[model samples]
Target: MTTRSSPGIAVGVVGAGSWGTTVAALTSANATTRLWARRPELADEVNEQRTNTRYLPDFTLPEQLSATSDLADIVRTSDVIVMAVPSHGYREVAREVAEHLRPWVPIVTLSKGLERDTQQRMSEVTIEEMPGHPVAVMTGPNLAKEIMAGQPAASVVAIDDPRIAGALQRLFSTPTLRVYTNPDVVGCEVAGVVKNVIAIASGMGLGMGFGDNTRATLITRGLAEMTRLGLALGGELGTFAGLAGMGDLIATCASTQSRNNTVGRRLGEGESIDAIVESMNMVAEGVKSCPSVIDLASAAGVEMPISEQVVAVCHDGRSAKQALVALMDRDAGSELG
Candidate 1:
């Protein structure tokens, strides 16, 4: 059921979606890396042909990368684990892996959404399922398709502990991929989750035929909301200005490839959230995250006007046209708020 740990560093990336596969492909070159796919067919495809056409169409997987349906092999063999599953599946998979992981093995999460019912952050969920294992979050403007294509990018690894952060940084860094370590796990994860919600709003502006001026204005205001919430939850202001915040916000808001933005555009074009979600194989986290984010803001006494409007449009059946009109109708206030 379990293989002996590699004498060298071995990394296990859970999930075989675009991001998971890409991370495996990248790290496999530096160390032994294995990707865990839920579907045996996808695992077989990756091992046999070095391609995951279902999720990563037209891209070649690295020759060093291998995949398996067995979570046990990964837990037994890996020195570290990177979780690339969607938020909905994060806790369940973490619980299962905990049964097999050795004590103190570091687990890094790439999930960028909050838990819906509890509104728990990814690290919080990990602690619940795998107590005492150091947890970190890797986030930035890094896009999966771009990274898989070997494009250059930088990202931050956020852990409260410095030593663990540095080790992860070295393990993940490559010629094309630069990794930075920050102690602001709170800031990084909070910003990572909220930016997806904001990108939806930005995309709605794009779909409604708004120009650059309007899009820029929306992104700026959205950043204001994001910073406000991040500050209340023990995050640094400087983090908000950096790559995990503004850089990530810009990419997700502007890119046609962003699933969240794409969903928002479809919403703007008069499609129902149910229909849009039904059609897509990938997860657009903002659609599920909006209500949870709004709840968190309410609990913190912070006002997130854009996220509230997104929830109304996506869940409460409020028309996108009406939502925009409503946002415009809000009482005038200080620019900072």
Candidate 2:
């Protein structure tokens, strides 16, 4: 266990959003954790009040968790760096961190979506910007508010290196939070990206007043879609059935706290995408990731009807009802296809 008794191995988390702040708080229990916020005011609030007013306003941060606006300070000093920025800003922040980061420090990406234009996973972006440094991705059925509220939860830390994966599992684990390690970085990352898109479809079903059967069908089919693309991209089959895949899909699709689910619900309830986006404070990754996911599926020659409809609804201004119709109108095929 790399606890505070160790002299070094400090954890630096970039971004002060709800998930970043929550992760910073979680790592502080095991190591000296420092968080970097883009806005000076948000950093000041975290340092002075131990709270991120805009993001995790309801939860109080651990005293051991500190905040800073200077990216270089944390980049140069910390032993481990966790990039928690959203997918859109992920590459930019990683490029900036590369300027001052030490040669061998491992970087963990907490973002769950793929790059918009490049369609690259967050870890891939990190590897491109900072080659030779070990890169890992931490993802699962974790909800920031529930984790911060002390509800028991588990997460997976996927890395190509077994030693680093095990070390991160210990670094992130707590009494209430259990961390598991997996060597399938590709599987874990693909699962994380695809589940958000499926969640949006599930939310549309719910908002349209569909019952449990409808939700179940969407989830099952969504899992199949996810598995196909994952395998096409060289991911393991078992990964889609693990926490980073099915577990996360269920949680995000069913929970009201999920931003993507909420956005889909609003759309099904007759709201415009522009209005929904304008009204929210946080990014709903599915809204932006939908198109990119479709592109990847096309490139892989995989059929993802649900994701296609979601892209239509989110980007092409198609109605949620129309999307459901389009899905149902497709020719039925073998379940294994």
Candidate 3:
């Protein structure tokens, strides 16, 4: 197994989606990065062409980056393993990785969402599947296409261990990408998951032709809900106001590149949830995470009205306009309430 002290720290990223490929490309600039694609053909393309044509066609990956279809090949050789699979498949992939992962190799998850069945964070799933490995989460206002285009962006690496967190912040940082380390893993993960749900609500407002006031209201209230739930789960309050919370929330809600926002806009534009999901090539985490967020909120005795409306629209088949009316009709209360 490669070591951090070694000249070449191998980074194995186990996903080939747009965000995964972007991260692999970023890490390849500093480490011997290998991306795992489930499809052999996609691996071949990344190896031969240095481009993920299906997911990230417009950007070219670094020469140092390579692609592999064998999960074990990547897991067995790496010093640090990045789990980039979607939340739904995250546990299964972590289990598969554990079968061949080198002892003590840090596992960093880039997927943002809660597990539907277990309602567990991806880091929790990682710990359950592969104990003794240092678990971390990398998240922020990261948009794949923009980052691939070499735009300046920042992210947070949340882990309990200061040493491991420092190592990851350095490994994932690029010339244009700044990485910060935080100890509040729970806060960062919760912020990342809940923002996607809120982004859908923001997009719904946009699609319904609501003014900026409505969007602003959704974002502000969503942050409150996110902070409340995070605190209930033992997360630090400051973490919610940091890059992982308010920063990520704004980007996902306003950016055109956000998958969850796109899904919500489509829903607002009169498309059925099924049809919107069927048409997208990528996973919009908020759709699956909506129900789980509501569940978590209810368990914590937190009222997440926006997430509740999102669940209704995505699952209960409520119209976006109806959701809007319902929200506006609610009894007025203090802003802090």
lDDT by residue (22-81, candidate 3, tens digit) is: 999888887889999999999999999988988988788899889999999999998999
Clashing pairs in 1: none
Question: Of models 1 and 3, which has the larger lDDT?
Answer: 3
Alpha-carbon local distance difference test for all models: 0.88, 0.92, 0.93
What TM-scores do the predictions have? 0.97, 0.98, 0.98
- Whichever of 1 and 2 has more lDDT, that candidate is 2
Question: How should the candidates be ordered by TM-score, best one leading?
Answer: 2, 3, 1
Q: Per-residue CA lDDT of candidate 2, range 1-337, in tens?
A: 2556674778999999999999999999999999999999999999899899798877899998899999999999989999999999888889999999988899999999999999999989999999989999999999999999999999999998998888898899988899998888999999999999999999899889898998999999999999999999999999999999999999999999999899888888889999999999999998988899999999999999999999999999899999999999999989976
Best-to-worst ranking by lDDT? 3, 2, 1
Q: How well is each residue in 142-185 modelled by candidate 1, as lDDT tens digits?
A: 88898877788888899988888877787777788888888898
Lowest summed lDDT window (length 10), candidate 3: 1-10
TM-score of structure candidate 1: 0.97
